[model samples]
Target: MPHLVLLYTPDLETDADIPSLCRALADTMLEQRDQAGKAVFPTGGTRVLAYPAAHCAVADGKGPYGFLYANLRMGSGRSEQVHKAVGDSLLQVLKRHLDALLQQRPIGITVQIDESQAQVYDAKHSSLHPLFNRPA
Candidate 1:
C-alpha cells in the first residue's frame, strides 16, 4: 500500500497542542472512506501529523482562507481533483475550529503527491512535523 504524509504550517493551537487536530484528521479520513464508494487517496488509510510552526503568522490578504500552508504526499501523482478534495476536507476541519484559529488569512496550502512508483526505500511516514522536516 502507498503511504501519504501531510504537513501543516503554523502551530495548530495557541499553546501548541495538536491532540484535537490529530483526532479530527483521523476521524475525517475514516468518515470519507465510507462516505465515498472508492477510497480517497492519501486520506484513505492515510496518517496525518501536525506541529507548531517556528514561524507562525497570518498574511495580509482578502478572503475566507488563511495564510496556512499544508503538504500532502502519495505514491501517485497528485491531481487537481485530489488536491481540491483534500483541501476541502481540511478546510472543513479548519472552519469547524475557525473561532480559535485565523481561518480567514488566505491560507497557503501546498499538496504534492508522489509520481514515481512505489520504491523499497520509501518508508511510511506521517504528514505532521515540527516545521522544516515534514512531508514533502
Candidate 2:
C-alpha cells in the first residue's frame, strides 16, 4: 500500500491544480518497479490525497508564503535503492508540478517517504484489489 498525503496552504488551492498532481503521483507510483521489474505498489492500493490547511502561518507571518508537504507511506520490504528511486521520482514530479506557482509566489515543497515496519499493526479490507488481478 502506498498512500500519498499532501498538506498545502489554503491560499495555493486555487492555483495548485492539486487534482492533477494527485493523478500524476498515482501514475508515478504505478510506474515504479522493483529489481525484479514487478510493480512496487499494487495498483488498487495506491492513493493520493490532498488537504488544504484551514489556517497556516508562514515564516514570520509575513507575506503570503505557500507550502506543500507530501508524505508517502508504504509497506516495508523494498531495498534502500528502491526507496530512493521512488522518493526521487516523486520529488521531481512535485517540483515540476509546482514550478509555475513557485515562480509566482514564495512556496516551499517537501517530499518524504515512510516505510511501515513489521511491528506496525495494519489491516485492510477492500474489493478493489481483485479488479486489478483480472487477466490482461
User: Tens digits of per-residue lDDT for model 2 on 57-110?
Assistant: 878877878999999998888999899999999999999999988888789988
Each candidate: what lDDT? 0.51, 0.91
- RMSD of candidates 1 onward, in order: 8.9, 1.1
Off by over 4 Å in 1: 1-12, 15-17, 33-36, 41-45, 55-67, 77-82, 103-121, 124-136
Best by TM-score: 2
Which pairs of residues collide in model 1? Answer: 6-127, 49-128, 65-105, 65-106, 66-105, 66-106, 66-107, 67-105, 67-107, 68-107
* Best prediction by lDDT: 2
lDDT of 1 at 131: 52
Q: Write the per-residue lDDT of candidate 1 for residues 1-136, one digit (tens) a residue.
A: 2333444544434532456766775666545432335555434345666645565445543334333344445455545575566657866775565445553343454444445656668554544433534468
lDDT of 2 at 4: 94
Q: Scored by Cα lDDT, where does model 2 land?
A: 0.91
lDDT of 2 at 136: 97
C-alpha lDDT of candidate 1 relative to the true structure: 0.51
Give residue 98's error in model 2 in angstroms: 0.7
**How many clashes (backbone N, Cα, C below 3 Å) per candidate?**
10, 0
